[model samples]
Target: MAFNNARIDAVPTLCASCEGRKKGICSALDCEQLVELAKASRKSTAESGATLLGETEGIDRYANILSGVVKLTKTLPDGRQQIVGLQFALDFLGRPYCSESPLNAEAATEVVLCSFTREAFERMMQESPALERRLYRQALDELDEARDWMVTLGRKTATEKIASLLLLFARHAEPPEKTGRHFARFELPLSRADMADFLGLTIETVSRQLTRLRNEKIITIENNRLVIVSDLRRLKARAGNS
Candidate 1:
């Protein structure tokens, strides 16, 4: 707690190096405010397959994803789960003022999060209009992404859908290590089954489409998980995206 009793121009130590502070809504706050909020914050990690929030789970805290991917899933009464969306690094993890989570949020990869009490977060939102507006903008961005996904589901062919899914991960997924090349490289975070569920395709169809992409040289698969998007322009073209 070096910054505890003594005040300086710096943010709290815990938040000084947080990705959320640089890229998320926390960027809207100044040093003093970050210090105040940091008092209520804690950093934690979850392995892949860990559930961060469940449907009907009471809202106790809000978090900013520090790293890795989180999938938001909606379950039907018949016991089917659909991956509705994904949260990447620096994405905010809770809905302000919501009493409970309506969907289940689970880690799609090993994840790091910086979480703070709901009251503290809400209080800060009230005090910092910038932070509040930032969150609102993020919500709107998610809505826009969802609308785009609707087009993919309703109009795209199976190959286009597979390409779209791969491009989706390419846009958000950060590989465990950097390859430092001209083209985009990422590890497919979801399994074939989960990807099938996300894209409304059968497991066999997903696999077949992936094989097609590999044969076309648009992408290279190392093992079953690591994917290197060799030609992003071609990949984007295949996905029917700009």
Candidate 2:
């Protein structure tokens, strides 16, 4: 688990002030464990489009997302790329105990990461069953989500696919607040091209479906990336979810 790359030492006070401390993988640690983890960790940020790890690259560390989004992508031999998954706030990054990344991880939005040296993180996980268990649970949940998305891509219609994508973003976004009559607002982290890549649809089709939803008064797009859901139930119905 040792990485030859330069390691950055984290400030203990920085870990104490992290917003994701309660929700991230570090949440499994006790106070003493947190101090130890903090000593081995560093805080870093990635701007949109920055690659955190390239496909098949050596992994030096693992990280917890404190804010923003990251996209995991795989490219075919011919250079076609597909976004395999998206990670949001409090999600763990890097394959624990593994030396290489199977896919590329890139920042989809400005991102904050709390990173730990691979050797340090693996040692901590080995000594802490709770931490290991929490990571295992997260892996299972991500596997389930991947399977569900497989169904969405293979079986759903264009409209259903678009609705499903919107629902996915809505669930991860800030809790819905009543703005006007029956409306709730959230910002979309993915661009239209990113959405299309994830959904296996053409950009035109994605745009068309979004337009259809807007015309139906189901959702409203503002400032390009902001979305306002007019009715949660209606949007879910269009997603083909009961």
- RMSD to the true structure for each prediction, in A, is 2.4, 5.3
Evaluated at residue 231, the lDDT of candidate 1 is: 68
lDDT of 2 at 107: 97
Clashing pairs in 2: none
lDDT of 1 by residue, 1-242 (tens): 55555655877889877777888989999888898898999999999999999999999999999989999999999998899998899999987899999889999999999999999999999999998889999999999999999999999999999999888888776544655444787788899998999989999999999999999999999989989886678999999987
User: Which pairs clash inside model 1?
Assistant: none
Each prediction's number of clashing residue pairs: 0, 0
Model 2: per-residue Cα lDDT over 1-242, one tens digit each: 34355443443586667766677788787766676777788898899999999999999989999889899999999999989999998999999867899999999999999898898889999999999999999999999999999899999999999999898887777665545544567788888899999999999999999999999989999998889896788999999998
Badly placed stretches (over 4 Å) of model 1 are 1-8, 175-182
TM-score of each: 0.93, 0.90
Best by lDDT: 1
